[model samples]
Each structure stands twice: as C-alpha cells, then as structure tokens.
Target: MTHAIPVPLPSALVDHHAIDLERKYSDGWGMKVDDVATTPSGEMYTVSKIHRHTYGVDDDEADPARAHFGYSLISKIAPDGTPLATAVSGQSDLARQDTTFGGPTTGLGEDLWWARGLCVLPDGALAATGADDHTHLLTPDLTAVTAHHGMPHWREDDGPRDPFASWISTTPAGRLLCTTGEYGLYNYGDLLDNILAITDEPLTPVSKPTLRALACLEADPVKHTEADLRPGVLFAGEPVGMAHRPRPSLTEQLAKLDPTSRPGDWYNARLGRPAVVREDLFVVPVFGHIYRSGNRGGPFAFVLVTDQGEFTGQLGGMDRYLDSPFTGHALEIAADPARERIYHLNRYGLFAWTGSGDLKQRLDLEDKRFKPLRHFTLLDCTPDGDLVLTHRTQHLLLRIPCPDTLDHVGHAVENALRAYAKERTDLKKQWKPVTWHWVDNTAPVHRL
Candidate 1:
C-alpha cells in the first residue's frame, strides 16, 4: 500500500478573513429599527441601531448624527458609563427614537432581514436562510420577495432546524442546492409568501398616494400614488453593505488535476484544508517545496521544485528579509520563471479574501497603525486596566507597558510586535480606513 503527497488548492474560503462593506441605501424612505436588551457577555440583544433613541438633543439630529439603521443584529453594546434606564439607551419612556435611516437608491435588491447563509442564486435571485429557521428569496431586479421554509433537509422529524443547510447555492439547470460538509441539499418548491417587510412602492396598489416618492404621478394623483404598494407585493428596502452578491463558484478546473482513477476528487478537503507537502497525500499537483528550520520553530528554509523539478529553499526566509512574519497572503510561496526569482507576493493580514463579489471593500486584515484595539479574552484589559495582548495561533501572551495606547509597545514584546507590524504594514497604498464594517465582521454568528 502506498500514500500520496499533499499539495495546495486555491480557495475562496479563509479563516479570520474579515472585510468591511460600507453600506449605501436608496436615498429616502425607511423603517423602524427598534427593540432592546443585552447578555451578561456584554453583547446587546436588539437588532442594530433599532434601540437608538433621540436623546441629548433639542431638535432632530443630522442624519449622520442620527441613529441610522445599519445591518440588522449587528452588535452588542455594553453601556460604559450609565444605567440602562437612561433615555440615551432607549429604555426610558421619555426617550424619542429616530426611525429614518437609508442609502442612495435601487440596485442590489437584497435588503437583509435577519438573513444568514446568504447564497446568491444563478438567475440573480438571493437565497437567504436566516436565524429564524426559514429561508427567503428576493428578485435580482428588486421586484419581488418570497419566504421559504420548505427547503428539503436530511432529517425530517421536528429536530431543531439543522443549521447546516443554512447556506445555499444553485446548479447550471437553475436547480436550488445547498450543502453541509460533503452532502448537497435540494430545495423542493416555489413556496412563496406575502412580503410585508418593506415596500419599494410608497403605498398599496388599491389605495392612493400617501407616502413620499422620488417620482410622483402627476396626471392621476389618486390612481398613481406611491401608496399603491401592498403588504404582499413590495420591493426590498435599502440594502446594507454589498447586500447584493453573485452566486459563489468553486474551482471546477481543479477536477482535471485530480488524478483520482478513484473517480471524483476530494472536494471537501479541497475547499476546507490548507496546502501541505506531506508524503502520504497531495491535494494539488504542484511540485514539492520542502523547507526546514534551523532550530525548533526557527526560520523555514525551502527547496522549491517546479514542474521541471528545479529547486531553491535556503533563501526563502532563512537569513535576509527576516522582518516579514509569515501570515496571510504574505506566507504564500510563488515562482517567477521569468525573473528567476522565487518569492512570495505576501502582504499583511490574518487571511486574504479571494471573492470578487465585494470589490469596494478590500479589507486589510491587520489593525490600523495607530488605532486602539480591544477584543474579549484574546486581547483585553487587566484588573488595573492595563492592556494585555495574547496570541492565540502562536501561543504567545504578554501585556504592553501602557494600558491606553499603542505608542508604548516597545521591544519587550518584540515577537508579537514583529508579527503585528508585519500584519500592520500597509502593502497597498490604497488601503482606506473602513467607513462601516458589516461584512464578514466580528459580531457573533447567531446574529449572522
């Protein structure tokens, strides 16, 4: 019996890869984002700014200063300095809440309503399975909306709705498909619902003009009112982030490379695992690039064997260019047969985004140069409130000298700082500070 050597596979999915989508909506017309509460974990219980109140102001605040509705279920705020009953927290009866929040105009038809496992279908419709154990659909042109609870599942008896198929996709024949690990699930019907969520039209069709419109009917004021919008027939509200997405695609070309006379290639391992150079198995067909460390966890020196069996590894990261900590895209090994150079186009960040769906938001995985960062458990403050940083992946943990600023972090924590600087250095000059980060973000997944 013999084993195969393992290799790399190009993939769309990556861990700790966070991107921010600056949400833009249709200029006017909005909804009531309301509700309130929080968990002991310090996360808020309401959906987004829904709990925001018009507090500490004499008149209506400017829109930017106003509590605009962002992604539903986006965060959990632990009020830093006051009691929950304060009017500013939306808990007091005297608090006035603002409901007006939106973006520029009609285009991407998907208005997120507690959606999860959002799969863009082949025909441009969106298949959104939500936390509510139900899936919803919206037309690409933003013309229709439908709710679906009947997508087929593996197990039938009322067990808690399997979160597995919460994600969806479609085949070339337009067949609705979803997946969990290795198995694909199919949706069975056109099961539709009366969309009461939001209306692109101002009023229900049977009634007259009651709501404001961008283009109001002049000839027949009563007949052509925006009020023509009805409960069941409506348009998606101003979408959040890159709310409109295209269907996800896999690297089907890899199938040809899969030398499995055993028939189908291992799609599961291909999508979920990282590239390796082990003797027992190679997922991809690239030549082996073997590397070694001087000591335990020291620098890795590699021998790059191309298709021609050419090799080079001593200079990979051994003696020079030692400042670059291997992380994210910066860790990838590449070849330049033309320049005769074997180097990585590696940049900083925990992970690199491979999706073309949201281009405007090119997330820099590393934290900003001079910004303050705080995370639970991993990077937190001590009892006296000193800033403590812990490296989860590298098993390194240390506290900085000053609790409030990144300015005081000196050579005492050089290893962590080196890794952090490698991640923080802006490789791309166009790196823009995120305006509003809602996509592939940090909030808990239950709010997904």
Candidate 2:
C-alpha cells in the first residue's frame, strides 16, 4: 500500500466543528474532504466538512433537518500539495461569518445539508452556494464580491421546495447551474432563466437494462436509499434518507404514468442532480438505476438534460468510452469549454469524451485492489484541460498524483493525453500553460 504523511486539519475543524461525520468515522482518521475544484488560472480549493447526521437521515420530524449539525471549511492549496493560508488573498470563511453584511453566517445550514457547490466564474472569480438560499461570489483574487445575489439559482415555482445544491458548474459566458441531491433533481438554477417553455419533449424509453436496474433497485433497498415508493414517485428520497424496496412497486409505478409517458422522463425531471454546461446542451446524470451503464468494467452511457432543464436523452457508444471504477456510479461529469467535451469519474478512474461521440481516455488507479477503496464522486476540470478530484474516504483526500501531476497514472494514459494534444490545433494552443502565467507546468506531461 502507498502511504503518505497525513496533513493535519485546523483545530477549529477538529474541535469546535462538532458534526456527525466525526462521531461515526472518528476525527482525523483520514483526509475526510468532501469535494475539490481547481481553476485553469492556477487556483484550487477543497470543500472539507463532516456533514450533520450524515448517516442519521430518515424522516423530517424524527430526524429534523435543523437538528443536523454540519459546517463547511473552504481551504486553498497549491498545485504542489502545500496548503496556502489563503486563495485570491482573502480570509477563507470570513464572508460567511460577517453579519455586518446581513449574511447569515451559517447560511441556512448550507453545509448542514448533503452538498455545497463550488465553481470558478468566467471572469476568474469563485462562486459557492449557501444553504440559506444565497450564492457567494469571490473575485479571482479571493476578495468577496457582494452583488452576486442577482444570480438567483432557482425558478419562481421552486422557491418553497427547498432546492438543495449537490453539484455545480459554470458556462464560459458566466451562466450558473445548481442541481439538487434531493430526489427529483429539482433544478432551480440560472439556466431556467432562458426558459422557452416547460419542455414537453417525449420521454426516452428506459432501456431493458435500465428497467432491470430499477427493478433491482426496488428489490434491494440498500442499493439506493433515496427510493420513494409512493403512488407516482418511486425513489425520490432526500439526500440523507434512503427508500425501502418493494418488489411489485416498479410494476405499480409504470401503471400510474401516462401510457405514452416514459419512465426516463419522470426521472429526468424528478431525480435531477449534478449538472454542467456544454456549449448549448445542458447535461445531467439520470439516477434511474444505481449502475446505469458505466458501472461495469468498461464504457457506459450517461443521461443528458435538455436545455429546458428536463432529462432528454443518453450519450453513449463512442471511441475511448471504456473503463469504470466498479461502484457503477458515475458520480460527477464536467465539461471543458475550450474543447467542447465532457468527462466523468467512476469510483477510482476517470473517463473523457469528445462531444462528437469520440471518447478520449480512461485513466484509473494504479492498484486495481484500491479501486474499491476510492470515492470518485467529486470532479471538475479546468479550462486548461487539467481535471480536479477531491472527495472523502477512510484516509481522506488525495489528488490523482499527490496534487501536482497525474504521471503516476501510467504509460497508456500519458500517450493518450499526448495524442489528444494533437487532436486539434486549438486544443494544443489551449493546453499551453504560458497563456495562464500562474498555471504549473513543472511536471513531465506539462512540458509535452
């Protein structure tokens, strides 16, 4: 096993930051980071927090959402794994704590819920969401900018539904998207502003395999705890909660929908979570089954969301679309605006695809035995083509190759990234680090 020195967390995090995650997993047992993000302009940040009542989520009353105790810590780090005292040069959690600005420091318990969003804005600023229905935008230099509340995340109708943000990403033009981990994938994002009309796009049929996966999901409650088996809703549970499986429940659900309606449609709108922008198309993962398509040893399909914010179709069957990290879960999918392509993390590995049905590469962990040990959920890519992954595990946070390089990923990947460089002249130009003076190119692949 590969062992590295454990970086200690702040006393505030270990002591006063009393939350459920520590009680269950033991404080400082490992890195324990929840998510990670890096900017093409040489800035990187990590979302580290132990969620409140993380495993105790059940009913609203029995386990009141307010009873949950969770707080978030956003820390900046250098590409070489050194923790920077600050990023963009401002105090890390000060904006949230300062009530002088009428900011609910706690943010409606944003960290109290399952997820908090992090993204670098188009103009080089950082934007993060709060549980209190607020969006925090920090200038690229780390100075907090207060006017970003103008960027409302949810639509008018979704106000009362409590749209929880699970994942977020930005467009080149600065448009923002926020998705919910709360079942039904309620989208109260800025993308809704361009609304033409509530989409009436025909629902794509849930394939036999997808149906079987759902059937199995209903059969095994633990596979996905978010399943709700009510008359119309099946598996729409909150972030902390899990649904019980009833064997005949799937059959009954099919009977309730319009005969012409597709199950995929219901899930697209209801089970929306984790979204990113790709040119004109908005993409989201279809949580129809625990293992949609990419859960196995190789290539799998991902569900796409229509511009209308409804799940429209699936993108699969392409070159380089191979390899999965075994959880069969495609946790996060991020798009590269420069190349106009998409990529995702499955357990311990990473896969990329060119928008034109050409998959780029599948770079996985060196030790296959450790594949099961990885938590590949948190993912985001910088405009310069570097992918950032930060998530929690027993030993906590670890970058692909110690925060600075991915050369440890082995020979095949190195060659693929090299060949990918030559795929398009613009791609070559974009990968050039000098364009962004701050970008680190000390690694071997960087010199390529």
Candidate 3:
C-alpha cells in the first residue's frame, strides 16, 4: 500500500530551551534522558542519568579522574520550562557499586537500569534493565519494586559481552516481552550469525535471551586494506594511505551457508547471544535485514528475510529519492497510534515506515551541521506529537508539525550556530584533544 508523503511543520511549534542542570548537580553528568509518563495533572516527567564510565570504552582509566560514580536525575518539567522537583540517585543505598573492566577505578551505580530501556506498565510501575544483570520494576516516584533476572542462561562464551540496551513490552496476556541488544565486542562472523538467528525466532523455553545481541550489529569495524599497512605522508591534512576495505556482502555469505539449518540453530552453536526476539516481526539495522512472521505464535518463524542484495536494492531506491544513500542506523522504533505509522531514526535521517515495513516518508536533516555524519542514537515522540532526537554531543527536541518545520529549524539552528561561532572565534583555537570525550557511537543522550 502507498502512503502519503509527510509535510514538514513550521518553526513556531518547535522551541529551544536549555537547563543549566550541570551547574545545579555538579557531581553528575547527563548521560541519557527519556520521557516516562504524563501525570493526571498534565505534568511531564523524564528520567536522566550520568553513567559511571564513558560510553564504548570498557576501561575505567579511559575516563578522566572525575568520572566514577553514576548519578540519576529525575525531573518534572512544567509546561513553561521550569523544573518542578528534581531527584538525585547517587546518595542512596540502592545504588550498586562495582568495578568495571579495563581499569582499576570503582564504578558507582546511577540509574543504569532505567537508562537501558524503560516502559511504564499498565499499573504505573516502570520496567527497566539494570547493569546488575536484572530487570527492575519501580514505582512512579522512582522507588524500586521487585527485580527479576529471568533465568540467567547467558554464558560468556556464547556471543555478546554486554547488554547495551533493552526493552520490555507487555504481551496481550500480561507477560513481558523482553528484548535486548547484545554487546558488540566479538568477531563479526559470530556476531552477524547470532543476530540473524535471533531475528528469526524466539528463544527456547529453557533459554532466557537478552537483547544485548542486537546492539552488536551497530558495531563499526575499521576495515584496512593491504596498502593501508604502508605509512605514507599526509596530504592536505588527510592521511595518504591505502583505501579502506568495503564491507562484505551478507547475501553472498548467506548463499554459502547451509540453508536447511535454522538461523538460531547455527548461531547458538557458535555465537553466544543471538539477536533473537519473540516479536512477530524484527528488523536489524546493522545487517540491513527484515524478517517477518506469517502468524503470531503458531510455529512462529521467519518469512521475509533480506541480505545485502535486498539491502542494496532498498538503499538504491532511497538514494534515488533522497539524492544520497541511506546511511542512518535504525535505533529505536515508535508507533503512532493515530496514523499507524512506525517512526524510527537512522544514520541518514528520521523515517516513517508503514505497518508492513515499507518506507513511507523520510525527514532529511542534512544541512552542514546536522549532516548525516553520525547516526541518531536517541529518539522518542512526546504526547503532543513532538519528535525528540539526540545525537553525539548535540541534542535536538523537535516538534514535527509538517515538512517545512524541519527546514525552518535547520536554518534557524544553522544561523544561531553561525552567530555563536563568530562570537567565539578564539574558542575554536582553544580546542584540544584533552577537551574532547570519547563516547560510544551507539550510546544515546537525553535530558531528564
């Protein structure tokens, strides 16, 4: 079915405001922010936190001396942009303290569970995944309820090393449908094989599959060709070495694999954590593949599966329409109950897909500053229809009223940045490597 193109909105619906939260809470860093639930009094609440270590790096020494403990910042923001009541987490006993890998520093607990992926249950209890390897249920007031670690079937040799993100959706029967992204730290062959299997079918009754495997697909590997091994002089501030190797084709690899075996069966034997989920349909952005189920729970299996060939075909069409290849990584998926539209953020831009997984509309925010150089890591839709997106170092909370709204905001932001740049000409010169912090390419940042 064909879908109508979405018109961009005007700039008036979009407002820009910054809170000097860092100044107020000097101990904490704002790592991620997510909208939880609206109160009966019409107040909006969000959960934010400061992570113990910088994203991506597993080592504690990689972070500066000041980065140790995690902190939680919960805020109730008023309609007029005022913070109602702010809550902090580090001073409490519920915080978990553990030493992370890669350094001698001790890691203090912030709200790591809340940041992974959170969903408010029908009973108003919050369900989230924790770094402690468990799922937590918390009250609306940010108090803990009960925690469940599931059955703990994870084996280190299985596949993924970390659980980057997780989501808990209640099934129609009230049981939880938990999905997690696998930590991306292993070999590509094992990682891809596991993800394809997980996306194909649900975990067995005896196995508890965490969502960490899915996150591995976002892993970016530096491909070096043989010529790159030779050192060469830099030209025009760019390295003059061998060209990078192109990513391998999944279609070609799949053709060589045994087709008779189930995707999971092959993955489970070699890879640790497969990207398997119990959902009716699953899509992996890293693999650029889509899998569907003909029926909900009856001998549920994969129907339509894509490989690099299909990925190239879809990208070819997208490039023709957008005048560039769709490079955006699909991070989060949100459903528009009103329009039945599935909105997701990718490396290229924000796109809306139909229920059948067909691309409907694309919001290209490819100006100079907002170019598709980095993938969008955080995405959420507000109750009032605003699309909030966060990138690396930059945060944008936009109200997408129409197509024009995106262009308006882009121009306004560019103009504002230009003015700021002019005022701080010396600011660019003062920049040093020490002033910059390395964040994982896949980590998300949001305001509380």
- The regions of model 3 sitting more than 4 angstroms off are 1-30, 34-45, 51-67, 76-81, 84-87, 90-114, 130-133, 144-165, 170-176, 180-330, 367-378, 382-385, 391-396, 401-448
lDDT (Cα atoms) of all candidates against the true structure: 0.24, 0.38, 0.33
TM-score of candidate 3 on Cα atoms, chains taken together: 0.44
TM-score of 1: 0.23
lDDT of 3 by residue, 1-448 (tens): 0010111111111111112223323334445454343333334445555444333434333333433445454444444323344434342233233233111121113334334445555455555554323344445554333434321222224422323224444322233334332222232321122222221222221233322121122223234234222121122233222232112323233333425434432121111111111233333332223234321111111112232112221111144223222233233555432333345554565555543556666656664575532433434444443344443332222233322333254453344334434423432343211122211112121222
- Residue 277 of model 2 has an lDDT of 43
lDDT, candidate 2, residue 143? 32
lDDT of 3: 0.33
Best by TM-score: 2
Error of 1 at 358 (Å): 28
* Candidate 1: tens digits of C-alpha lDDT, residues 137-190: 543322334434422222233433322223233322333322222111112122
- lDDT minimum window of 10 residues, candidate 3: 1-10
Ranking 1 against 3 by TM-score, winner: 3
lDDT, candidate 2, 207-270, per-residue tens: 1000001121122222222232222112223122234322333222332423654444333222
lDDT of 2: 0.38
Q: Which candidate is the best by lDDT?
A: 2
